[model samples]
Target: MINSFEVKETNEMIEKENLDVRTITMGISLLDCIDSDLDKLNENIYNKITRLAKNLVKVGNDIERSYGIPIVNKRISVTPIALVGGSACKTVEDFASIAKTLDQAAKDVGVNLIGGYSAIVSKGMTPAEELLIKSIPLALHTTERVCSSVNVGSTKVGINMDAVKLLGNIILEVANNSKDNDSAECMKLVVFCNAPDDNPFMAGAFHGVTEADAIINVGVSGPGVVKKALESVRGESFEVLCETIKKTAFKVTRVGQLVAKEASKALDIPFGIVDLSLAPTPAVGDSVADILCEIGLEYAGAPGTTAALALLNDQVKKGGIMASSYVGGLSGAFIPVSEDQGMINAVEAGAITIEKLEAMTCVCSVGLDMIAIPGDTKASTISGIIADEMAIGMINQKTTAARLIPAIGKKVGDKVEFGGLFGYAPVMPVNNYSCENFINRGGRIPAPVHSFKN
Candidate 1:
């Protein structure tokens, strides 16, 4: 349905507003690369990834130049490594070797990051999964561009409190290991509830086993464009505002669909879904929080913030689904504190809190993303936060994730700088209350009664 657009219309959106494809990710399944020998497994994975994604970076660059649109990152997401390495790997070193191979493959192909160094423990952890999860701190610390994720809960299955508790300690260990760089390694890890299979976003993406051998997925972003559109409808009713946002999102998602088509064609791979997530950057105009403020909120975490975010998220999906029939992934607005300037500003002010962000996540696509907490924050407390968020996603039947950065040697009000697109975040305060007892009660939290709709 996307026909040729007027040159003037396209230029206005690209040059004036921050409209661009966020990522062109090639999802390469490494399932067949599995081997019972650890060394052979690593070799097979590296070969498969390199062979499948050889032209990924060049293709993305070509698309960006030919279309005059920015394609920010070229990435790869492989089959979840826990399953792939289950037969071969035994100890933490074996898992880390696979991570090393992934990192090498990413660099070899000129990709920015490679995801799927992950474990899906929603039901429970196997011996292999437990080893992979335990090795995450070392794997992430040693590898430059390898991202890891762990799925701890879902609607069908209950929350794995044991995995949640272990991840809390693992997060702290990762932060402590990379403290000199402001816990930069922690930025590459994520904890998810109801994790998506086709997400093109980093730190949480993995090629689900259900997917094809190789496919191309695109992520589109245009918060600045949405904000600009809202400016024309200032003081309008909620009905008018929602319609305007939907129209803007439609146009934005169409761009992503076009890019996905081009990339799939050029790479000779199947065209996967276009992820219509409004991913924000540190740039001033490109921010989800700015859109929230334009919707009549004074700040991002104000009293009505949750309501505003809910409206925005719903309208975005409505608009995007109209533009692309194959829309999948975590397709909604992201609220990473470090990635959005408005969110960082809100944190610097007293407007936002950890608890407030939790409330907002119930409406947003992801939960508690890129938030920097105090160094001394207890592992039990982090697990407690994860439990609450997992509960939200399971009950609501949506995807939610946490990427908390424990800023070592920094307390509330201190700044931890990641620079570049990661931006900087002021270490936010956490409640001093202990949740050790609750976290220590390590067992599965049963699925909600409503999940029995069979």
Candidate 2:
């Protein structure tokens, strides 16, 4: 099954490039855990997660050893807790306790992060959902490995002003409470439109209602591989470069499909989606920004960078679509500022700015991720940033999210270190324009005009 050119590329990926499977997520549906009795519900939650994911870490390690490809993270995304636990609780604290239990379960199973402690309040918020939203600060602050998200808007229902309002305060509280960690807690939270279920990525994954009781999904990452593929044709035309990248992505996604199929068969779980995100680690050779730079941009924020990213995203999808029928998630390149070394270097070198990053998000996969801003940045300014990204997703009918950290005691040009996969970032400046009146409107922006097409 191996052709000469493809084998050569694969060898280059393993030897010179840091190509590897990023994550193998187990989507465990927790709907069956819901119960009228709080104690029974918690017991079911722990038992289900433990039973499904007890051997996940071992299996991932064994596969890595067998294939010589590193699996960066082992993660799980459960059904939205608000749906399962919302009706069982009356107080925010009660819901937070449930989050703590989930965190412990993740630790027990040897997974680094567990997602789906979230609510889909795009249309409206129920009492339990409201309580959970308000308790996110405490839950995320107290738990080490729990990731939370809220889908406050979607193409179908437009943006929810009430949910958006609460998120501003929630983000502020999460930041302020975790200020000792450079507001690292805020990094664990994401607000989005059209969030995906089988996303084997962190901070924004939730098991959708359409999924089976349990399934295995894989996230494949190889920015270095794609960049290396582009390097061979340095002076090639743009069309040639696009072809190279597309061919490389096809190979990478095929590897992902192979790995997911094998992992699913071994675990006796149904195979799920292959999230073809160019997820970068804090390692030396896994930079998503490096892909952009190698694609002929001086750095990720150069004048033509957005156009380059748009092309890259399209070609990647085109190749991946041919590779597998189960493609989903943010399947293009990621531009998380603090997570990629080249992005950190770009920000330090004055090649990228917050505004340009925001503009780039219009075309890229995720929006304004892991950006550090001045501690004194007003909550309203943060709200304005969220509103802007939400507007892009709402209008384009794509998924976009913001994860901005207001680092306490840090200013523009100052750096905040979050250690490990979170990497580091110099504070990026936000515009001084006031959005008080707009944010203060305190009412929904209403569903976009496109939503009425039905």
* Best-performing candidate as measured by lDDT: 1
With candidate 2 superimposed using the best TM-score fit, by how many Å does residue 124's alpha carbon deviate from the native? 1.6
193-247 per-residue lDDT for model 2 (tens digits)? 7787677888998898899999999999888888877889888898998898888
- CA lDDT of 425 in candidate 1? 92
- Measured with C-alpha atoms, the lDDT of residue 48 in candidate 1 is 91
Per residue, candidate 1 scores C-alpha lDDT tens digits across 399-424 of 99889999999999999899988999
* Candidate 2 wrong stretches, greater than 4 Å: 2-8
The lDDT of model 1 is 0.93
Clash statistics: count for each candidate: 0, 0
Residue 350 lDDT in candidate 2: 96
When summed lDDT is taken over every stretch of 10 residues in candidate 1, the lowest stretch is 1-10
What candidate 1 gets wrong by more than 4 Å, as runs, is 1-5
